[model samples]
Target: MKFVASLSAAAAALGALAMLPTTSAHGPETREEVVKFLDQQATAYHCAPAVAAYTAARKRSWAQKVLGGAPIADQNRFIDGYFEAKGLDGEVVKKGIKELEEEGKRIMACDPVVESKIRNSTCVLAPQSTEGPYYHTEAHPIRSNMAEWQLGLHFEMDVGVIDVETCEPVPNILVDLWHANATGHYAGHPEPAPHLRDEKPAASGLRRGLLSAYPRTNHVDTFLRGALPTDQNGVAHFVSTFPGYYTGRATHVHIKVHNEWSVLPNGSFTSGNLVHTGQFFFDDDLNESIDKLWPYNTNPIIALGRTRTRNWEDSLQIYQDAHDNGYMPTFDVEKIGGVLQDGLVGYITVGVNTSASYKPVWNPNSGRAGGVVEQKPIDKATHEEL
Candidate 1:
């Protein structure tokens, strides 16, 4: 039997709402009014474009374990309302319903394909160390509060001519990405210690004098925002360090991809608008080292040593042969369980469009006090909505 990961009908519904008319003064309608309209549309199409069967399976498992019973109906209602509020109703709802039905039938018709487990052969045998103008210096203002050095890895996935419905590679897909820094820190304009200098006494490690403003060097803005072009083989490479793990969440990067059809309001192409959010994991040793420290130690998702590297290989140098002219590392997409493993590896193939199959696997606070998941509700208290 062929196994196919289900696509979220909510996504299709939301996509449709993006084409709807909004309310404005003499214009269409207010944001709230437009939101209400979409909600009604989504309600009308609720059952038609319900959540994917695969997603429902995972949720079913969780509900049974945690809720002691399957709240499938309640969950569906909540999801539908959430999508509706996001303005994904009407045409989008109809389209999503069709897509869901087609996907369900495909899964039911074929046996699932079993994927072979791949090994994470990459490792930082000798961790590279670099010195920075420490302690709020003019050049490197941010003081390192964490004991260990942190790294962040970013990925760009290219879905080469593979229609999700047909399971074939579609050429010329674009992926966009952004993420936090190694120290779980973010870099922004007018750095925190703009006035600090790097002339502190090394022996005493004490703050020296008023920091001087030096010309910014290596200002690549690694904090976030970058896109990569895929190769003929339908893969894109990113030169990034392993991202540090934080409290509550495991170590991972953020990524998104866009097809040719996705466009902006001005009829221009937008990058990474497909919206796929996923977290990547590292090897057992590195994870263990990270867990020994704070934040990650307390994080529930930081499962150390539980995940082992199946086929371990080391010392695969990138600059070994004359043909190696600083090309990006390469790995088989079918191998590594559809996710990038951690460490400074030269090449990785976590599978293109892995995020495309991604679904909300876990929700820490599903039915807690003051916890609610709406389609895209604006936080009235914060005046922020996503």
Candidate 2:
């Protein structure tokens, strides 16, 4: 009887081991790994009173030993607090609560949209990866509007920063953002992607290295990129065109969070700790709708009749931005007007551990953010422009 019990215990342990997620040295090599990691972090946030009593009541079950859990009215007030603290209009908070309650206890554990909304309200950690090849550190203007007369659908983004360790809003931190224009070209970089000009596909290896450092072209143009310090409420706003898709990736935006950063005399940020590097994506249905629009339809690569990669199809990187249960590195967008072309607004809350930092590599010869040009010839193989 003892031997039989030992064998069963061993079998059960192995089963649990098999259920754990596995990742490559580079990070989150599989979709399942990405989803599982996100779910775990989000679950941790909800289980603990990291931010508010609401989180505790959110997951409390009547069957649990603890009694007098927060009621639905309390939950509504908790949800309202976030918007009220942000100074948002009362109508918006009321509508947000209505929808949040409608979702009920299921929480749609795996749905990206639901997760995006939940994470936006609470301080949950965001994954730090996939800065992409086009990033030019310290080379973005400190301005609210990054559009610079670029032709595309207007987009306004409100990004909030929260220190996950304390579960509180973080102020004065620099948030830098960049993305492709309507025609699938990033401002300042001449090529859509490294060595993939003229409608050619980038190598799979290059796709995997989306977060790896690439040599900068040092181009002078700075459209579609901007930086700003978060306010006391830990929010920064920017106006830009909606991001268009590039080859080998989905429609996404790149973000970098900086701490102890200073603004340069040239109207750009200087030195700071790169605390978090991550990407945000739009839903595939939204992407498809935008692709039919004027300037986006004019993208030369897509004009060749090639289909762009969808969110799920870009298996390597998209999963890293998504959580299986709690968080998604995507925006909760709302139409500001009757149509998308009219205008759109999006909001995302970034959760970061202020104690952590990163040293990102970029082109040393890149031009300054304020229209100072330094042209250089890039070595295609090494992506090094010397």
Candidate 3:
């Protein structure tokens, strides 16, 4: 298998209690309340408008996840009392229910005609997580397509960005994505390799050029990893295959947002700030289906051969903890055709603070984390390598 791989500062009490209201001194009782609440809450959390929207709409432990967890009922009571104290009203209390109803309608009305439909889906703000041992910092360029692998069905994701500051779409931000291949292998990793490739990855032309360079691992196969900028509507459409499950983690994808970045004269990178770094997960049903499939069943680490298998291991408690904290976001999966081996679509919106700085360091040989490791190009005329 291939190796891969935030807290708001609210006081435990008052920060957990009120969190500055989205309504007004008078109260938000109409549709206009939507804009006001979104702006206010988004600004307070230093997140995106979509997050505020989901928090206000989902009406779950969002506050507890962000602020603190008392009890949902107790939290609601505190919120109502706090809203009353701040001069808000019932409309604000019921805003989340309305948002839920709207989301239900959208899910029921899913359409497949649009080639690049994602930002239009429901928005949810998620918790932040570390990139783990596998996040690479080498010079990988921005590209949209990531379906250059031999195994697994197609998985397309469209990332939507919400500018929490303006409660509007975040245009032109970079979306970085990376995941393991179906055989539980990551490109550029050199250890814990599979016993046999079945003459597959190479035979399929997927592991062609890079296989010879790095014999110890699949370091040359940069499959299922790429980056691209969001469009005007704050969206990036990506193509990839459903990833294979690896040891110590569940089925998930790693994401990072860079607000300002550029390639430099010396082949290095220059950037402005880190927008966001988080993950999106799949439905349990989807996970189970993948585990029971062909190449996924070939996962070198996981045992039991699919039946009764679950993604509940792999230092997985951290992810479960994040979900309990309400910082984890899940993609709305749409699997089409018989035997999920066909293809599917997953979507999620990331909220980010545009002002954060880019401070990242990659440690190769750090637990065999498989990701980008910079390599020098060879000079043809001089027969010299730099």
Name the top lDDT candidate. 2
Give a tens-digit lDDT track for model 2, residues 197-293.
Answer: 4434445542531322323565688999999988655668899999987655678888888775777888998754567776777767788898899
Q: Stretches of candidate 2 above 4 Å error?
A: 1-42, 46-122, 192-199, 202-218, 318-326, 361-386
Model 3 error, position 384 (Å): 40
Candidate 2 accuracy as TM-score: 0.65
Q: Which candidate tops TM-score?
A: 2
Residue 95 Cα positional deviation in candidate 1, in Å, after optimal superposition: 34
Where is model 3 more than 4 Å wrong at Cα? 1-125, 193-219, 264-271, 302-316, 337-339, 358-386
User: What TM-scores do the predictions have?
Assistant: 0.31, 0.65, 0.55
Q: Rank the candidates by lDDT, best first.
A: 2, 3, 1
Candidate 3 per-residue lDDT over residues 67-172, each given as its tens digit: 3633333343221212221211234533443443433222212311110122223233334555655555754446777877457878778676765444445667
Better structure of 2 and 3 per lDDT: 2
Task: Report the candidate with higher TM-score, 2 versus 3.
Answer: 2
Separately for all candidates shown, the number of backbone clashes (residues 3 or more apart, or on different chains) is 30, 0, 10
